[model samples]
Target: MATIYDVAKQAGVSPKTVSRVLNGDAPVGARTREAVEAAIRALDYRPSSAARTMRSSRSGLVGLITGAISRGDGSAGPSGLPDLFIVQAIQRVVAEAGMTLMIADTGGEADRAVELMATFAQHRAEGLIYVADSHQRIEDLDPRGTPLVLANCFDAAGTPAVLPDDRAGQRALVERVIAAGHRRIAYLTLPEGMIATELRSRGYREALEAAGIAFDPALVIEGFADHGEGPRPYIASALDRLLALEDRPSVICCGNDELALRLYGELRDRGIRVPQEISVAGYDDYRVISETLYPPLTTADLNYRGIGEAAARRLLALIAGAPAPTEAEVIGGPVCWRQSVTEH
Candidate 1:
């Protein structure tokens, strides 16, 4: 029930001076600011965000559209809301920046993007962030000139985006594998067209080339991309082909922790002992799979939360009239080593 006028009277300052101190729109003397702050605390004053917006013409609200955060039953798919981590991070960052975040879940439907964005515009959101579950391209979105930044996904029209450094992460993991004495390595990758698949594939080859190992076309195999696809046929086929090669790989690198989990079962069913017959590693480090597996799978962290924070920061800058980035901001995370991988 306390108002700015009450705080101003207690602080012995004009309401405008209290407004300046509260909004930080104009400079105030340190002593005056301290007095106003102390008065606000004493009165438990809560400023009207609407009044501030009316005066400053800033809503102090950011909108986020994501398919990864939903209100449905907790079981969306095998991945089970992978982008939720990113959403939480964005929420935290926006709150810390003194802005409110309005989130709209698309329910895994891309066609709802424009509608959600329109709603955000109606609410006068100062900026927007689109968070994707994985690295990919989003098409046919109408921003209506709202400042927008992407998280874990990119827009084809050169929108500023913050994404995981898939290529660098994969290359670093491969480098570590090589350092562990792995010469012939096999890679089971996600489906062909995904951004993570392409980047990680390039990184695989780059690491091999850097280590003076010839790029063997036979070592790479395409695996399931979506969580719903499951990991049977693709992984089994790839494992069969790899096992038949004259120079069979000493280590197998999987696209993500889910795939690595399936690979462990397949290998065990075939009576192959992990790290004794063949070393295994994975990416994304979904702890349930990576840490709980028999040998504890070695993998790389995707850094989705970091990507969310970065996207929120970039969108805030863009809303303030800063130049948008022409290329994606790539954030890198560390590789995790576990008992699944050994000196091969």
Candidate 2:
């Protein structure tokens, strides 16, 4: 609770001198500086960041708004906690640049975003970052002159953004499957409306066309909702249909690690042997599902941390009055080849 006035009084100096010593704004005698430092240590005095911000005309604080809710009772939804990997990466970079990060969660409610934005603006944050749970378009956010950056998402009106290269990531994974000698590859994609669904499906087709394989409509199935109720009945029916085809696919590519996990159980119950009768692969190398399975899964990394780092860099540049990047930053992760995929 010690203030500059207290330090000044204890040091027998004026408050202006104390400010000069603390902020190096002006020259102070060595003896006076030493006296102020001693008083600061003696009283355990902490300079008020707000006061410093007002004097310097910069807050040295960045606000981050996320969709992940932190329940006090320690509960996580089926998708587990929101992707904090990106936030952690952003924090590290921002701290390296001598700025502190202030985070607010939207509790998965989009309506709460405006309130959070207003709070950050009121606090005079140097910039703000809006991070979505996944790659998608975020709308209705008014930056209010505070430099804003989007992480793991984008805005339709062309705001600065950092996102995973969903299409390229999927293309790379499918290319890996093809390299393993799987000619007939089936894909279980995310819901039709999802941004990832469209991008990843495009990648799937691109990879097939690159390999001189004709795209097979029958092998592509839309994924079902993940209600944590084992695998959906529709998924099993879809799998059965794929398996019954005259030229059945030799490998099944899942939308994500979670879907692959559920599919693993469903495939097991049907007496299908992984990598023997059929091969499997997934996206989003979510360790809990990808690494824990009896056979580790082959999947694509989302590179969320990379996204965070890019967003931080972009925000910092914008805060420095640099021109905003014309295109969204697209980061790509490597393919994690594990035991789930087998050579044909």
Candidate 3:
């Protein structure tokens, strides 16, 4: 096996200089760095992670706790799809920052998070991040002095967090719907009591008010059951109510792509032609449904990837002794316009 000494000898540099080049703790001249790098490549020298940690006390490892990977059915919190996009984005950012990510799945049990934190601590992780499958509040997480950040979730404990701006995302999409000349817009909302449900509802109303449209309670209906309550035929029921209204809505905005996909089926059964008889839109921009729909569905991009990138950056900053954010960072994405919505 090639050693640091062998690399130093091959590069015609002192062992201390080689250490500086390898660790990047001290600056090395360009030529010296080039020589060391060349020697490392030629010898295929692999640095010992344990030895590096022993010297700098930084494991160069970030701990991530998420259920994104362990969900056997690939079902996640509201959208019913795994939050793999967020995890994938976090992985990219951590790798680009030259840090190793140690991911631990919660196995769909939130109570296992503390145990996972302990395991990561034993591995000497410099920082930790917890990612939730949906936008909600998570409580009772005690980081035990380790720098910690939350992604796609928040807590009252003031932990630095990065979350999707649900209110803004919904408002933006609705504004675009209105801009396309929609007036009597009906909303098929997620189950009540979820954080996103309330925020997005507020955004929906805000957009309507801004466009000089009166808020019609009858136009809004719950489109799904709360978690743990077996799924009911909420979409069909909601659609029936909307269609029965004295003045039917010209367009319907669904809670998420899953609901929109379901809505598409119900609309088809009712002989409704999307954007011709009635327009349809959704949230979360779950492309499998949105893009593949007969006339690609319009929706909001919740920017889960952006949330992950922000969370990873915030964790890295906290690990570097940066002050925690006074409030959670909120990330928003653009509204995607497709054939589903028409200019009335």
Best by TM-score: 2
lDDT of 3 by residue, 116-141 (tens): 99999888899999988889898858
State the lDDT of candidate 1 residue by residue for 42-101, as single tens digits: 999998877877777589889999876564443322232378888999999999999999
Residue 145 lDDT, candidate 2, scale 0-100: 83
Q: TM per model?
A: 0.83, 0.88, 0.86
- Alpha-carbon RMSD to native, per candidate: 4.8, 3.2, 4.3
User: What TM-score quantifies how close candidate 1 is to the native fold?
Assistant: 0.83
Roughly what TM-score does model 2 have, to 2 decimal places?
A: 0.88
Candidate 3 residues lying further than 4 Å off, grouped into runs, are: 1-47, 75-81, 226-232
Off by over 4 Å in 1: 1-48, 71-81, 225-230
Q: Tell me the whole-model lDDT of each prediction, alpha carbons only.
A: 0.86, 0.86, 0.88
